[model samples]
Target: MEKRDSMDAFGAVSLIGFAALIAFNQVVIAVVNEGLQPVFFAGLRSAGAILLIWLWMRFRRIPVMITRETIMPGLAIGAVFALEFVFLFMALDLTTVSRTSVIFYTMPVWLAIAAHFFVPGDRITPVKALGLALALAGTAWAILQRPDSGEVSLAGDLFALGGAICWAAIAFIAKATTLRNVTPHTQLLWQVGVSAPILLLAAPLFGDLVRDLQPIHLWGLAFQIVVVVSAGFLFWLWLLSIYPASGVASFSFLSPVFGVLFGWALLGEEVGPVIFGALALVALGLVLINRPARAQVPQKVA
Candidate 1:
């Protein structure tokens, strides 16, 4: 399919659905963390996802070969990817979904900052600067404010922040290194393939692999392997390939909103006024950051 310059109705609907899926995923992770140790669960997810990804590629006839140029960067991104999930999974385990979601979804803010330094032509415009300020403030606020009714932890918040940084670093590696030359499938394969063993080996140090093992947790792990890791991420990459990146990214703020809502509605996590205010600020900042610059009209000779 040809790339679109902007988001059409189909793209808009798809993005909304994707955002909701991701929001609900946070709740799923939190629940699944009950039966499995967080790091171990993440490792298992990565390990399972590798086989699924490989099968998908085989079915789609997408080559799985890694170029020599991309090998080092691929390994680097995979390591970073493992670290990202380790922090994120642990964050959800240690804190409320609402808090973790609000903080973890701050990935774009960190990505923007890194892009300014490393990604050529991706500078900090005035609008983006304002967006950064708002997002940073909101993130900080979300971290500092503790809810009266639900679980909150400084360690968990910091873990989420660290996850956000790792997420940004993965994006940076993709943008700044030879990894960008590879297919999305190959990039994903690298992440899961390399991270699986790293996560599994490291999982032992964190704790026993299993906790109060349950059927639902197994089901959740399957869901993560199939829906979230393989299909969900691929769907997102498909959208990015087709639609304008800025337009696609503009829908991201909805993830945290839906996340907070799902946490409140599903997990019965608290959503106080402070959290809502932080959400508002971050959402507004995301809008500003992703808002496209107006086109310049060429003037005729006067």
Candidate 2:
């Protein structure tokens, strides 16, 4: 659980960097989907991230020691991490990046709702409530505006929702379990290390592992493992350990905004007027939800 630490400038920068990284990730996932099956690609990245993280730690002389106290929680988070990506990758394959991002980035709403009951100091204030309404409305708008000419899928939307919930589950578990006390790398180790084998095993179940295999796909997988899975997640965990999670989480709204624009510019995906309007609402809500208050935002501790 986080303490009542509010967001500072450095925290804001970190959130922005993370948001951009993940926003770009949507484009990468879409590109990679051409050569690798969604689930299979996810599984490969999970496993590859394990090696990358280990190599990184080794180079940094950071010892990754797992004590008995951490095993169970680590394993639990690992499983959740695996499931989260499975749904996410599948959703990306089944739908456009704009649509998938619109739905998937609703994570803050779900997290706030769970925090209201499970986390102390997380009660939604009037402003926050309004923010939630706006954000949720934006998500609903995105789901509804399946542009007849654009690619959209119900199954994909559901899977994206599932992925968002699982994302919240990871946050909740981190707050509630011993993970809160561990180092960021240790926490990430639990996720990628545990998730690797499980995902690799499940890959075959999703059918053929390879598509029109290409060098670019391999490079994309490397980016997912080294940049996103290893470095990005570790940084997020560290942020969670130091800053108020609510503030950190509020930044997630930027991902969809960035994702949609990137999708259009990079992938040539259509962005309808409805999506632009939805982005406005979601952005407004995030600004309010993350607005600095008089008191430090109390992060929930299990």
Predicted structure with the largest lDDT when compared to the true one: 1
In candidate 1 the C-alpha lDDT for residue 277 amounts to 86
Clashes of each: 0, 0
For model 1, the run of ten residues with the poorest summed lDDT: 144-153
lDDT per residue as tens, model 1, 29-56:
9999999999899989999999999999
- In model 2, what are the clashing residue pairs, if there are any? none
lDDT of each: 0.90, 0.84
Q: Tell me how candidate 2 scores on lDDT.
A: 0.84
- Candidate 1 matches the true fold with a TM-score of 0.97
Off by over 4 Å in 2: 1-14, 239-247, 296-302
Candidate topping TM-score: 1
Residues 1-302 of candidate 2 have per-residue lDDT tens digits of 44545788888998899998999998899889889998889888988888888888899988886888778888999899999999999988888888888788877778778988989977878888998899889878877767665357877888888999999888888787778777778778888888888888889998888999899998998899888988898878778778875688678778988999899999999888888888788778777776655667899999
**Global Cα RMSD, each model:** 1.2, 4.7
Candidate 1's C-alpha runs over 4 A off are 148-150
